[model samples]
Target: MKLSFLVLAGAQLGGVLGLWPQPRSLQTGSSVLKLAPTFDIHVNVAHAPSDLEDAVSRTKGFLRNDKLGRLIVGRGASDSAAIQHARSLNTLQLSLVHGSVVKSITDEARLPLGTRSEEYTLYVPADGSSATITANSTLGLLRGLTTFEQLWYEYGGQVYTVEAPISITDSPAYPYRGLMLDTSRNFFPVSDIKRTLDAMSWVKMSEFHWHVTDSQSFPLRGARP
Candidate 1:
């Protein structure tokens, strides 16, 4: 027998500010930012910047609209490492030249978040020349990227546009934000679980509680057994 269940999640973006769970702080600007059919992404690499590189790569992969253009990655300033190792670091900078197809993104510092740190600050300059997303850890970067992606809307059913010129600084109010899923009672397939995870990521959810064993059945197989 095949059983299907629907899960409903709600998110809200209000006038340059997101209403879903609400960020710590948000400021809206006057101008609207838009992306061209194609654009360039430049990643500044200095030392072993694997984490930042991976962040950019994953972000690019998420945005598979084909509207993205050339990807240029190079070595940044020598002091880049020093900046990344700072303690009180929580800032991101994003710059986009209006009428230009080039966008520059930089993370200020990658501070260590003990256990859970969803804290991030995003800035979209009113001048429209740039924007930034700052966070303490790579996890914060992931959250910021998810929020940034939500800013873009599809046009004519093909193109993606970001109505920007806004600033947002967000951090989770609660450290433990997650959802619980019961597989024993209903037996959800792997694909279904993945789909749920995708949705959770979009909303900056950090946990997935799987209740696999119950009175109904123990579908989970043990590798040792």
Candidate 2:
């Protein structure tokens, strides 16, 4: 809102508020304000509430604070519906990449039936100065929160600041995108599946193909063989 400069630690500091500069865009004085009719925001991967927060925060840094907004969080197919439901309440706009939508904000913590621990994409509104979030698993939620912190930390607190009409175009390249494991070939952990799913989402894969039939019976417990 205001701009001033002071010399401390042999470096000149200014009271300018702006998005942290990145390779993608210019860094103007932090005090710049954005005027917009629509906003289009994108978050590649979000599986926890914290990730939603960070994405919202980064988005705010780039645009002028709006009274209403939309948020889209995309996750792997295995993500629980409960996580996505939790994300809907606070967002000015809410949508899941491939996640389900919940009917009410009051029930944001409901996960999908028979989903695994790390499979979820939660979104929350960035309308208020801050949002309130609750997850079925406290630890899982914490991990999501940490993700937002990391995005800010890694980018030195520069948020995604821009003033553009809200429009987004996203679609998967394949009909079925998924995580595949050969249990008979080798035993892979859940984390590996999470990682693979994340990669698939980036490439717009919406289906999962599990080739569990091998010479030996590794017998993966989650999927029916």
Candidate 3:
């Protein structure tokens, strides 16, 4: 009787401890599973510089993260002294903002800039797959990354996967980017100007002209605010 009582207690403990075999369907239903996409990036660079090692390393970190998409950087002219210098600095900045590797460095890149057309000519990869980013300024390139970030964040924590190729042909028609500021017509806030400048940087636009006339004195008090 005592042995039987001990066996009963052991069985009860086993059941309480979940040692009893569970049905396959029940166990399967409790299992957690996830699906993720893969990425393949390509980069094209027109120049390369000596100080690009650290930048490239950090960029590789960004590319390898699952949240961010794949990236590839190709160099066009790594040997050119002038181009190399420019790329060294720009590549560093690009890596900090966008994780793109400088893959191929070459010296035979020619960008077209014309005065008549309003359209901007942006050199992008063919093939109709993968995101193509082209920028004349490091700041503009950073802005592109910000734009991508915004889009990705909007879609929750899902990774951005793209297989479609992009063919971008862009160029600015205006020789000088212009800004019209009218402090006279209406009271303008300083914060507004700062925000506008931030937006302007995204497009690689420089403020060539500012028309801030303080003629209409509605209430000028803050000493050239």
Candidate 4:
């Protein structure tokens, strides 16, 4: 069984940016900041967790457009889970600091049954001086990160920008969220499965039930003794 889960928090923005799955509480912003080729992201912490570091690394690549080189994350903090305090110096720089890091993304999935922690809060100041995202686990962080990415848009056919002065605090309304996919009746390739997973993540859906085998066919490859 392939099971995935997601919980949404509330969101508030300063302006109307119309986000998917609509954050529980969102306040849209007025100003918009363009993502220029020179835009850079810097992760600042004392001892960073591997997972947080990895997230930042991936974020660098995801934010990359055109020939913009890969971004680098600075080092700080060591705790697996800690609150981060950061400030952006200018429009060209973005800073992030977390209180603690989650060692693995799967860690949230391992919580005891009925766990309701997949929540996160994000703040993008109107001044654009800095942005902040806070969560109890990396799962929420990931969700917030996805939301942050969704905020960016391509303008003039080449530039990307996000509405400024946005704030969102999101959490799931239900304790258990899941999606079911039957692979037995209709074959789905690995890429398709991944796409489904991505879509689920975007909507903060937590559960992914993969029906790999059914009465129609049993194609699952079991471990050989």
Candidate 5:
């Protein structure tokens, strides 16, 4: 019997090393990425769904906001600046496209037949010429965008992402990524419910089991035919 621990000399652990529910694979190369202030999102599909468009817009809004406290994955960037002097680097933009990924996560990617998978692959070049997030469905694109934002942090009044030339391929380990709320027992306000759903979507939760009815109370209206 034997055990071995391979240590990453250049890489650190925790927020300093990765994201929450870290990707199944995250390989980092040398260099740093100074995220563009106008870091925009573009969809490559022929006709992006309205919901997908809306998600991309929202992702664009939050990705460049220095005020967003969610980019705490790798906290202190003071000493990690790749380029000390503000030199002209390529302005990187996020591009999302439709694609399938069945490697390693074949079961999760294909199970529950006809399900819209939330599997995605994100690649950011060390040169910073561009970045891309590819997924099999819109759900996957959303997750990719969330991971993109988490890669950035504010340091010395500049937004940057360490560990450049990054490649991440991830999918849910379990098929049921879900959340539930018993509105029949304790109804959350419509606005509050919406906010909760939005947060869940950001975290890439695929299902929301809303308990709208129970033996004690029936609170939801039926859908119109």
Candidate 6:
């Protein structure tokens, strides 16, 4: 039914065809939706994180600037008229609410330091208006965005398209879902670690255990890693 790669929402994100780790509950529909070039991202709650905007920007930028998939555009053209014509687009509203972020951490929205709740619900309306990602916290929102990225694919020499009228309810089965790397036995560069962390975030991993210090080696000693 398809011919080419979907030009990827981003290297670190996933979509409908292959939502990483798979949500607990998911239901899709027959209708399809198109993401306009200037689609907006809006949050419901007040005082959201700075990272939220940046993350959304990076996530959506992949669709706008196509590097390889330009069959629709002529060889020397700077932009795609098909994409630009739909500048009047609807916003992808993010309805983010606060839940019990963590049982241990008391104060509200200790975003950077503590383990926050990561449960989220994604809704794409059948009528194709105000597609929303509802979540209990910013952490949950991050997870929802990752799943949203995977839903889109390049359709008929075009990009930023997805099957709409879908709903998903997702949460980690275990709070301590984690991945540990035994770096004590081997040395890893910062670039390698960054890529690994991105991959971890894509799968919604709760923790990463960098086993840096063992009896024999201390690669991350005496300096910040």
TM-score for each of the candidates: 0.63, 0.31, 0.34, 0.70, 0.72, 0.71
The regions of model 1 sitting more than 4 angstroms off are 1-14, 17-19, 41-55, 61-114, 157-163
Best by TM-score: 5
Q: Per-residue lDDT of 1-225 in model 3, one digit per residue for the tens?
A: 999999998655431122111111111111111112333323344354432333344333443452532223322122223222221101112321135333321111112323222231122122223344455433334333433222211013332212112122334434456566666666668898787765564443545244555555555456775
Alpha carbon lDDT at 108, candidate 5: 45
Q: Write the per-residue lDDT of candidate 4 for residues 105-134, one digit (tens) a residue.
A: 577766765774668788767554656777
Q: Rank the candidates by TM-score, best first.
A: 5, 6, 4, 1, 3, 2
lDDT tens digits, residue span 30-61, model 2? 21112223433433334435545554554445
TM-score of 2: 0.31
Cα lDDT computed for each candidate against the true fold? 0.52, 0.32, 0.33, 0.58, 0.65, 0.64
The clash numbers for all candidates, in the given order, read: 14, 29, 32, 51, 1, 5
Q: For residues 105-140, could you state the per-residue lDDT of candidate 6 as single tens digits?
A: 122224443446777898877554787888776667
Runs in model 4 with CA error above 4 Å? 1-18, 44-47, 65-103, 157-162
Root-mean-square deviation of every model:
14.8, 17.3, 22.5, 12.2, 6.2, 7.6
The candidate, 5 or 6, that scores higher on lDDT is: 5
Judging by lDDT, tell me the better candidate of 2 and 4.
4
How many backbone clashes can be found in candidate 5?
A: 1
Candidate 6, residue 184: how far the Cα is off, in Å: 1.8
lDDT value for model 3: 0.33
Cα lDDT, model 6, residue 52: 73
* Ordered list by lDDT, greatest first: 5, 6, 4, 1, 3, 2
Worst 10 residues of 2 by lDDT: 149-158
Q: Report lDDT (Cα) of residue 184, candidate 6.
A: 88
Return the top candidate by lDDT: 5
Better candidate by lDDT, 2 or 3? 3
What's the lDDT for candidate 4?
Answer: 0.58
